[model samples]
Target: MTLRTSAVQESWGPTAVWSCAHAQGEHVKFFVLGSVGVSHGGPVLTGGPPQQQATLAVLVLRAGHVVPLHELTAAVWGESAPGSAVMILRTYVWRLRKLLEGGEPGKTGAQILESANDGYRLAVPRGSVDAVRAEELAAKATRAHAAGELEVCAEALAEAGSLWRGEPLAGVPGPFAESQRSRLAELRLHLLEERLGVDLLRGRHERAVPELTALIREEPLRERPYGLLMRALFAAGRQGDALAVFGRAREVLADELGLDPGPDLRLLHARILSGDPALLPAAASPAPGRGGGLPAPLPAAPSGSAPTSPAAHGAATAGGPARGGAPAGLDGFPAASAG
Candidate 1:
């Protein structure tokens, strides 16, 4: 049977399982928000074997899309795939379907895990997947922040941040898992930076200092965090510390990369030096609903346009992934092909 894949946009509510109920009103829930794993009802499901788990991870990473056989094999076994790779993969798919469809023994229908033309697709309802829900919340956070509804933005980001239980796809070994883990980690960092921006904009400069300091130390060469630190310090009336931050950033950039600070950092440094009143954090905007409330659902990119990747927002740093390549040791996989 041919099952066509489509984008599922519904938000995840408190009931975090798929709408597909079984004999007892329970359902299988597949989670990929943090660790690549699955649980049915209350207890975590197990006994699929490592290779099978790796196969499931590959499919879950691109849930709702058909990942072709060759691509699956490439992700799972890389260049060293055994001659029986295809057969082995098929067996893995069968096992996963059984695990997911365990409610009905010997069921022939493709309800959750459906077979596509040349690949497989896990057909869970919208928001059932934690990663998808987190993405939606992050999108909402972006929208709320743009509208200057700092509280709403913070709320949304907090919810999004809570979804991550640990490193994504943890313990699932493969090039695909490695790359996805890096991508998800970078996305989380971007979300954290966004929330930090909201904090600074809402005049929580002092409160943001500790977090920004930690981020800067963790990613010393990341210009955006350094810039944010400078702004936060200046807003906190520690102008000397702010300037010292700029000086240290300059030295680090020059010594490590044979480069200088980017224009944004340079401009902030100049503003701090000049005591620009604009450098001081503005008074917090009124809460949402009191002449507030950012519009629901952020604006979409123009037709046929791709939203910018997180990497494009900043310069490549010393220990981070380089431009346009699956993080070091993490081989890239093709985007999910339409089922």
Candidate 2:
């Protein structure tokens, strides 16, 4: 390999030795998953007040994109921002810049954070933020699941789940952080469900049952987990238990929310009652015209959401919590009226 290096290329940090991340100079890795912090090739620096962390969280989320002051103010203080909110925000930015640089006055000039015309931008290196990495992995899982590459999908989702440290954006104070925290947490749940689905496909239904049951307990109203649990139980030869789960889901929805199970669950119940052979794992992902005419699989994931299905059992959602609506039927089968 001939050497054709330029002065500007050298200024962009050591690119050739990426295997060591910071093989030469100090590099930064911003994290938004669990707690908001940065790793400067050593111990993570998580020393900041809640509001400061909130500011960093917002910029970290929209990394590489400019965030205007007005938007930042709204995220940081919602509708109760004090008159000096802007000044305080600026101070937070300065403190964050110093903290990332180890507080050295003349640290090498590699400013990851920049202020442009009317907003600030965070330019952390790609794959440096766990949240962003999770999203990317989720996308990979989604694609694999869609293409019937169950093992690959499971691996990607598993890797994505491992990146989360704790409660996302933990201890960060701001509307933006709160919203993002909820979003990231839900993404993890969806990925978990997807992984479970892959396990079910691989004839590991016994293992999926307990996990799905626990997920249902935590999110009783989420119909997706309920459906997956039923599938696992039914696959493990607990047909009666599978139907009982449907009954429990119906009861919970009726008692707590004054709502019946969505069409997705209702249809799944009907199919299970009919003993649809397509529900069998061996028949999953069968050719479109074969498999006894089972319904089509889930649709592609929506933009800006988790790259996987919103719900494991239906076209309910692959990104976040399923909102109340006209949902499609269960995976691998068509819709049918509840029995």
Candidate 3:
């Protein structure tokens, strides 16, 4: 996966992941978007043992940066590390160095992994790591969206989404792996919302419905998805269903969080109640005024989820995934306004 250098700079700024230059040649491709492993130049498609893989995962996540000895030990064995932990870590690094450098290195004899401050840095070429590449794509997508290039934005986010194979750091045990997994899951959600926003802007409301539905089911308390789903459903000629969506959102918010919908959501409810033509798909009608920008929220599926497809992005679930329940209604919603 190729990434734009500008995007890398945009995302990381002064503290980028590793390299800004897109270097080439015999570096092995590292993957942590799914399983923790490496490929290209090695006989073993995956890397070494569980602990070794965990060690490498720590390095891969911090690729281009030094990983201190203490952090490495915690990533591999947590606080219960044995006295021989240092020796084991060095041994793993030695084996990983060989594994990463096993392929041919004729003209471009790039260093795979290096040691600094007695710390480790996996110095593979830029864009060689799927996780890093995905972030670059996301950054690019953000730029494209800012430029009003809806199709380009959607494509870049979709490409980023496709890099995921499964649960991040799959089968790799340790605190680092577990934490990174959750972090990446959050990124996936942001990517999904980005794509959905583009789709909605491009007048793909019908297309956004299923995802919005799944998102609402997964995150009943979040108002953004509910708003998006309501818009999509309203534009699809299901105003009744759209109203029902607000009903569900109200129930869930009241029950789960013991709160009423915020100003944005209540105002949206008012607009829908007042028959805002701006809610129509953009392709069918022009939005004549301001104060109509939408928001995002998602949930309901068991994720380690992948992006919807090449055109769309992904869905991610979070804590206390909603069950089939809602609370009593609260009053004082915003009043409908005449535009």
Candidate 1 weakest lDDT stretch, 10 residues: 330-339
For model 1, how does the per-residue alpha-carbon lDDT over 122-210 read when each residue is reduced to its tens digit? Answer: 66543445665566676676566556576887877766666676777667766666666666666666556656766766678899899
Please report the TM-score between candidate 1 and the true structure: 0.73
Better of 2 and 3 by lDDT: 2
| Candidate 2 lDDT by residue in tens digits, 1-339 | 112333322211222111124222225666666677776544457839999998888777676778899989998899999999999998988888778674222453235677877878876544556666666777787677668677887887787776677787888887777667666776677667667766766678899998888888887877777888888887777879999999999899888888888777787788788777666666443555664755334454333334422111121222322434523221332211111
Instruction: Please give the distance, in angstroms, between residue 305's alpha carbon in candidate 2 and its true position after superposition.
Output: 7.0
311, model 2: CA deviation in Å? Answer: 23
Using lDDT as the measure, name the better of candidate 1 and candidate 2.
2
Q: Please report, as a residue range, the 10-residue window in candidate 2 with the lowest summed lDDT.
A: 10-19
TM-score of each candidate structure, all chains considered together = 0.73, 0.76, 0.74
Best by TM-score: 2
Report how far off residue 128 is in candidate 2 (Å): 1.7
Candidate 3 lDDT by residue in tens digits, 136-238: 7776765665565768878877767766677777888877767677667655655665567567767788999999899777656656667777877888888
- With candidate 3 superimposed using the best TM-score fit, by how many Å does residue 287's alpha carbon deviate from the native? 9.4
RMSD of each: 9.6, 8.6, 10.3
Residue 188, model 1: lDDT of: 64
Model 2 TM = 0.76
Q: Distance from true position, residue 299, model 1, in Å?
A: 15
